[model samples]
Target: MELDTPVLDDHMHLDPDHGRGIDAVEDFAHLGGTHLLVVNKPSWHLGVEAGDPDAVDPAAAGEEFREVFERTIKVVEAASDVLDGRAWPVLGVHPGLISRLVDERGFSPEDARDVMQAGIEVAAEYVADGEALALKSGRPHYEVSEAVWDASNEVMRRAFECGAEIGCAVQLHAEASEDMSEVAEWAEEAGLPAERVVKHYASGRLAGPIPSVMSEKERLRVAAESGEPFLMETDFVDDPDRPGAVLGPKTVPRRVRWLLEEGYEDAVRRAHVETPQSVYGIDTEATLSE
Candidate 1:
């Protein structure tokens, strides 16, 4: 599928072994993308999480991240040489992995988070001066129980403190639900302007008790009350029969346009995939060769 504007996948899965190569990504980005906010999530955990069944190409992408970041460094460094620094070399640990690493790798959750935070901090300062670090959160278990919630929040906060420009996804697979107050607390602690920290993927609903994130009025209300930030996104998955699944981009943008028709200005901004790319320090306009 083709889109006139950059279609941002707020939560993307580009693995080391099976991702589009650097050249391919650059070519795609040059097509119209301000830049792809390349989140280094590896292969997918299939048959576990259910995705859309209507996409043209269902890409079950995600699994482990040990190599994602390692490969990311290589790609980001290569961007300067290959794409003339147009690559959005993002650096942030996936929020969900906080517990996974602890349970599987046997490290104290706090320590694991600290190391993750350390990488984000170092990457922000050393790699591209805090411009490129896509500080993200919205870990699935965030609102479920305090144990992982606290850990996820701490990780986000640490990344925030490091001056990383923070953003979070409004994911579907969660046991804890999103309460505006709780979300507000997380946003406040992270010092993320409500707009800057987008709650994306409105396509899927939170699995826990809650219903919708914020009502149309409530979304505006949250922005007004907190004077923080707000935005919307269609977290399109690569389901084979889905319109925007995989390499295709649709449905999500229409929903965002609907938000605009209904008076969600921030929602429009969220639709611009380039905003995060710019906020996170990816040079979208850099000249590249085909």
Candidate 2:
């Protein structure tokens, strides 16, 4: 599919495996994708289990985030080298990790909150310093205890507060069944604008206070009909063990091309150009034209 307008992938992860990481970005660009927001891979801090924050020392988690940030910077740099500065970074603490810290790392709710706050502060600093485009935080709805779920929300609340202070967007990774309206309300209470909050990996039917990144065709149609702005993403997790786990990096561009072909050109433009620019403060015209 040929796309006249450049595409933006709002959510993706770059694995530490350099070969696969480079290939992912290169393939995305080759498929007409111009801009990407590469989220820090979960394993960077969560380890092999991808949720076992207990495997690492609590003190080392801070260092782990630092390493992840530095490594993500390198990945974004390499992607920009290939895509001409179209790739950007989004850094934050995963909600699952917050629960693990409490369940496995012997952190009380208060202690976990402090650690979560500190991590979010660093993410906010990165945004303020122009190192990242946004901050990410969300709770997993499955395989987690109620206590952990509650604690995760508390931590995410703090993240929203930090985002409000630093003027950065917050990308959520919660489940489809979760109430997005509640999430948006909390973000508003934290002093962040509803439009600045993004629900990652969402479907068209789920509408809330903030916009969403939907990949399904039918969902895209539904979202477009609402007259609300949205974005597209593949949520590409570049893990060798689970190749194309969620979707391929080219999925968003392909979907956008399909939308264009279907005469939803205005919807495509609103999602890929206007919405992202408004949410992340990215100058799509300048970034893609470059």
Candidate 3:
């Protein structure tokens, strides 16, 4: 199934041990999908233990997250063999893990934040090394104590700072709401432009960061009609335990085809090709050719 317009999944995951892995990528490609921003799962998901919360060096403890980022990069490489340069890695510590570190791993809120910020630093290094193009960071989507919340915001700021230093984008897994203007302001104050901050799994275009909305027809139509720049994703977790946890792997390309068939060729191209190129600074046409 060839496509004239490229299809890029803004957020996705592939786990060989617990999910369909690269076969999911093949499934996506089989439906004319062209690219994916393959993000790293939580540290626990990759068997990365938050060892020694009592350790003196928080940075050292954070180094454990390298395995998660590295494994994610490896997955991108493996997927790239199927989709070529279209599979880009986005690396960072999962914000939800902060709560687990404090509540489950016996880490203090401060310690958890330090460890997460350090992990973001490591992810920035990978971006610097060209292994990834964006940094993932955010406060927990659920409620938490003020201390943990402050610390999580600090960690997210570190991601913004790192992204600014390296001239890359930041993908946030923050709490879902209609307004993210405050977070956008935070990104701007940290020297990372609001446009470079993406709201992952977003439902609509908020005031601040760019929205990476799920591939639902009504949402896409609203986004397209608004004339605001946005991107689309399936957010496929690819977990075998919970089949199609978010959306299926083929959802994006299939939706693109649906949009085109419905005479939304221009909107589909803007969402799939133009918006992604502008945000990630990648030439989708060049990648699609290769």
Candidate 4:
């Protein structure tokens, strides 16, 4: 499990109450993977019921999300003991929940946005308190009404603002697209550099935010060879029903080893060492040594 450079999965999830949880971290550790950014799951996944659309109290909305974010931080703290490097929490409301708030919960688009923005503000509090390393937010990747879309964008902008104020990164679960000029513009307006904004589950090098590319061999090679600032991830949801669905916990380390064997030494170093430190502002060497 020892590696010369730290292998960081920039975006991942562990559902201790429902899935493999820390055992998944053990799997990664056993394969030479070192670090993780454990993102919070959606509220429903963490056992938070959908809010009453009729009572969209902006003041109480964050309290509704508190348990979900706290649980994610608890898991990350526990996971630090299992990982060879470290596990940092990335807390926020998942963007996909917007649809549920609107359609299933009967929330109007604006109310749903207010609820989500409040959740992001709560998440920023955790980062500000030093319990988490980053914030997670993005517009829905699925179709929605134009009003819902506009509201979702506002929520994302709020995330950017929170991240800027807290002086941390924001990991985005956005649609798969190369042209992210609009998002780049938003980052600029929020005063958080595009380099600190990561596109989670990205397929290749992207325009705006730094990409956290899925750790498949070909895609990894493309991103590495492009010589851009990027990171790698499994995007492993750790769902027992869909075991090893997106990619297994062992995927990142194994792929990094494969690239090392392929003589991509510099590429491996860029991905595992340099880029992560530059983007997340964490000391990879210091973390792995610990």
261-284: candidate 2 lDDT, tens digit per residue: 888888888887799888888877
lDDT of 1 at 102: 60
Flag the better candidate by TM-score, 1 or 4. Answer: 4
Stretches > 4 Å off in candidate 3:
none
> What's the candidate order when arranged by decreasing lDDT?
4, 3, 2, 1
Question: How do all models score by TM-score?
Answer: 0.53, 0.89, 0.96, 0.97
In candidate 1, how many Å is residue 166 off?
Answer: 10
- Over 4 Å off in model 1, which ranges? 1-9, 22-34, 42-70, 73-87, 126-133, 142-145, 164-181, 189-191, 203-270, 273-290
Global Cα RMSD, each model: 10.5, 3.2, 1.3, 1.3
**Global lDDT scores for all candidate models:** 0.42, 0.76, 0.87, 0.87
Candidate 1: lDDT of 240? 36
What stretches of model 4 exceed 4 Å from their correct place? Answer: none
Instruction: Give the local distance difference test score of model 3.
Output: 0.87
Which residue window of length 10 is worst by lDDT in model 2?
43-52
For model 4, residues 60-124, the per-residue Cα lDDT tens digits are: 68778889988898999898898778999999989998998888888898888888998899889
